[model samples]
Target: MTLQEIFALSPIMLAFGVHAQLSKTTQNSTSNVKEEDVEVIRIVESRIQRLSSGATGLGLDSYETPQSVSIVEDDTIANYQLDDINSLFEHVTGINIDRTETDRTYFNSRGFDITSMHVDGSGVPFGDIFVGDMDTAIYERVEFIRGSNGLITGLGNPSGTVNYVRKRPENDFAARVDLTYGRWAKMRAVADVSTPLTESGTWAARAVVVHQDKESWLNLYGNNRNVVYGVVDGQISDTVTVTVGYSFHDNNAEGNTWGAVPQIYSDGTQADFPASTTTAMNWTYWDTLNRNAFAEVSWFINDDLNFTSKLNHINYEEQSELFYTYWNTGLDRQTGLGLLGYPGKFSAKDDTLIWDNTLQGNFNTWGREHTFIVGVSLADAQTSDLDSAAMSGFDVMPAFAGWTGNEVSRPEWAAPTEAGFADIKLNRYYTAMQLSVSDRLDLVLGGSFIDYDNEGEAWGASTSTTEDGTSPYLGFTWEAIDNVNFYASYSDIYQPQYYLNEDIEPLGSAYGRSYEAGVKSRFENNFLISLALFRTEQENLYEFLGYDDGDGVDDEDYSDDFTYALYQGITVASNGFEVEVSGPLNDEWSLIGGLTVLNMRGENGSEARTHIPRRTFKLLADYAPQWNEKLNAGVSVRWQSEVYSETTGFGRITQDSYGLVGGYASYTFNQQLSLHVNVDNILDETYLGSVRSEQTFAGSPTDYSVTLRWDF
Candidate 1:
């Protein structure tokens, strides 16, 4: 379908009540509802489950929460065949992924980078530098909050926050197995089992194992991955519960590239390369391993009060031997003779520990019910890196006319040396209170106090710093009618910088503030629609002026050997609006759609981060016809506006507007067996996956997958 048709379908579907077979399923009493209709509704509701207390600590639903929230459940993951975090983020609203390299990816939202991520409401470290691709088999659902979350995370950026909820052991005994095969010589298998350990069903254990091997569209690239996860839940007494879990993930990839393909040639003209072109050699590789352990305890004091404690630990390691190609003298259009290669070997290790405690309760005051929450958290992390390089000559590459990946041979490496080291500690105390001022209005107040410290060295430079600060949050919600709510919120956060100034000193810290207002409505048949407007301001951001040559003067001759960077602080602001609609259109159709528009500028009235798209739209829908109870089908569409990046010699690198189409179908043979088929890029559209002044990468072509599942 075309973009115009997709945009117009939203209102038409809601107004006309298309496919009116399941309209009576929403009634409080199922007296007139059919047995099959009731079952369909139940399954739909479970697939699109809602979260309680995802934005604030007062346990408010999406309609009552003052911030915008979105969730992706297990059913959606399986239907789309999303195996890693990179693929999952593509379906989330207002999110963009930057595929800078084959093995590393960066995420951004609202014209800023996302720096905060949590598991079960507890903060953890996240970034391309800390870990590689994360597997999604251990998570039941992922929640997103589209604004500054100061009350939950003490120090962070204003882009957004992500929370991953884990899958737990069930009270019953069940098992499932799946085998999948896809294009590009890809194969996968998964096994999951859950059972009760006692006759009383008070204790339970669950385990999951996964293995996958796949080849990429790029030349000479492939990967092998494995995952193992296990969890146990026990009831110590009628009022107490305990849970523990562990997970391990390993990924090994060959022929990994360090950067993207060059975008410009020597004559300041654009260069065109095939989608299958790559700069990696046959001997290059990147491997990573991640391990996580967590434990939790809960106590139910009464119906209105409760307490919980959690502990989490993580260990991550990575090793890579790669080659980076650069065009210092620019590539010749006829011969491609100016390319040079730099080979390096590197390893990294990261360790983290976190502890959190929370207490919450409700009370009666002034003829109204009020709720309060208090929590404390402590986190410590350490990271170290080692590096090595070839001692002899391995700098020139053969001509690109008839070049193959096997042309270059492995180089001799030198002794490894310490590249960087860091130790970070954070302690935070937070509190929140929700007051029901009247039958039509509510108020929320919260804040966090944080103490942060870091000590380490990076590339022969000291990175030690210390800071302490407080972040504040406030919000209000008013019920305008029977099923409508109007809300507004304000919050702020702080982040310490690692960049150095001309005098060789740290740049202190940066601060950010967010303001938002929105309206939400719940229509008949459980349909939800929301419209939101937001503004964010960030100050003290570092900007580069020039490279210093130790003589207090800017010089191009020492560009490769500069001692320090001349930096200054600047302020930036971003304004945006979003509209989202999700729910079942009728008994047979379910839909999720969103549109986002953004504009960002610096203090000088110039556009900032021009490489990010200014507008994006996403739509997904599923159909389960009553005529065929055992068959289902779905479709997905995504579109984005133009983006451009500027460079000194290449003028501008631009990527025009583009759209993608995908679809899936499934058939159930019996109660214990099923088959599914998925097709991606059905339209066979060609586009750039990433566009930057330095380099660019091509997106994937049409692909297909088939899966067989069994349940017992």
Candidate 2:
């Protein structure tokens, strides 16, 4: 069918499906129905399932997984008013969000960076500058598996893996709309609708739309975002199902700062600046666009075996013009007049395709029941030539007097030039087996073989390389008692490097090992508690040496020419402990909380990883009065220990320990309408939100939002 015809027939299709379903329930009427229609009706009446797909790739319960797993469901998203995927990380245990750049965000897990991402168990390329801008409204839930996950991710950091499960079409008709208004002229609107598309109820469709426009606390900074997502699902037969989806997103921002305010002034004294201080120029801006499409097919051969396949395609583009102010020479403590600003333009386009196929089954071996899975994946990624340019002799800004938040005209420059291009392809084959040695004990074994080829050009130099290796994985679980379980797992993973080393050659990939052990407890399946200890070690780690050249000539610095170099052969280690509790405390009260203690250092026993905190805690609870079914209230608190920046000859800058408190309340006036009010940073604490070698970003202050939602 044509696109226009499909759009016009959607409502009619939904209404017909609902009417057909209702006709079957008439008591006095004898109407003959098709066999397939009967089956579809029965399936549509079943309750929703909340199993974790990313935990083990076996569709097992969270408690049954051998590793530490956390799930943030749809209810949690609405209760906390988490608008985007990045906001959800703040509440997860042992995970930290680092805003290193205006358009990029890094998720730090247990002192390691989370570089692997998946959608519905299908691996995809990472490192997108606009990944953090993804809206969570279209996702059913997010699943996180902590510790080594090489068995499935193939090539990635050992820290963890994140899976975003998109919402599927509903068997019955449902629709919802939300409108929100908040501080700093923030406005947001979201709409979601789902319904059956065929009379037999075998086909279903869902669509979601979102729009947001907001201004930040930083001087003259603002952003506008728009998103659209749609999906179609069909049960072709009793044992076959198919799904297809597409998503589009665009974000544009003006007056974005390339870096935060300077941390220290000349003379070695820390600089004190207002929270509204900004490093952005009036003409500086950043924009990004992303498009994605995916399809999946599942065949249930029998109760004992199943097969599935998934394919995905993605296209992303980003363009920006930024200005950076650097203190080339030591600033005079008294004058603060030693800073110089430079401007540059950058644009990049990326396209990727991924395909994954798998087969799993249950069988009996040696009189023991076991589960086995085999899978293969392929990925191809390509980037267009990067277009870039720089303007010399641009006027510099003086920081001694502070910023005035006034508009500044940009300087005219020369034409842009093509810098480089790159292409990467990866192939992986993996398998895993779960053996039930006895009723109370189980063992899991898995491994993957990866082959990679990369070709690129940099600084007019052509480069091509190929690498292949094997990653092994193992895990086991033992039921210590009826409601308690003990688990342990280990894996070997690697990370590919793209930068040239001190020898002016591309660095070899780094290798790492992860080990973890934990205890999990369940009380009546409604409450859960878990405690885990983990340690990780890596060799030949890559580290960025900054723009300064050892010689005193500023012109040779990497920052001036946009060239990057890396230092290798550095060893690093991290060990940490975590405790988490979630679910209902009772019929009236429900709570979710966690605590983490971490210690990370270099081989020489120095705290080289400064962005991660040594201690962190989070707590959120909700209460509903037995006498009032229409009202509910909740409160949350978060705390983090001191964190420092990378150490330099000038010393280190630290963000002191701090805490924030927030609360929310909701009232349901009727079955179809509700109102909610949320207040964040209720205590109005002032602290540093993020830090870099040269800049620091302040946390947000007290803010309030009101939302009205309607369902039909």
TM-scores, in order shown? 0.89, 0.91
Instruction: Find the 10 residues in a row with the least total lDDT in model 1.
Output: 14-23
RMSD of 1: 10.2
Please provide, for model 1 over 1-712, each residue's C-alpha lDDT reduced to its tens digit, 9 standing for 90 to 100. 4222432453321111000111112223333556645433322222233233477755566788888887777778888887788878877778877776788776778877777788777765334222456778778878888887787777646778888877776657888898999998989998889897876565778899999999988888888899999987655554456677888999998888887677777777766778777888888899999888777766645546667777677788999988777655677888888777767789999888777777877789999878888988888778998988656325677776345777667888899899778888878899989889999799988988888888877666677888898889999999889789899999885876666666666677779888889998988886788898999999986665554544655343333333455567779899899898777888998877688899999989999877788998877788999999899899988888998877667567777899989978999999999999999889888777676446756778898999999989
- What's each prediction's clash count? 0, 2
Q: Point out where model 1 deviates above 4 Å.
A: 1-53, 125-131, 500-504, 542-569
User: Which lDDT value does model 1 have at 471?
Assistant: 82
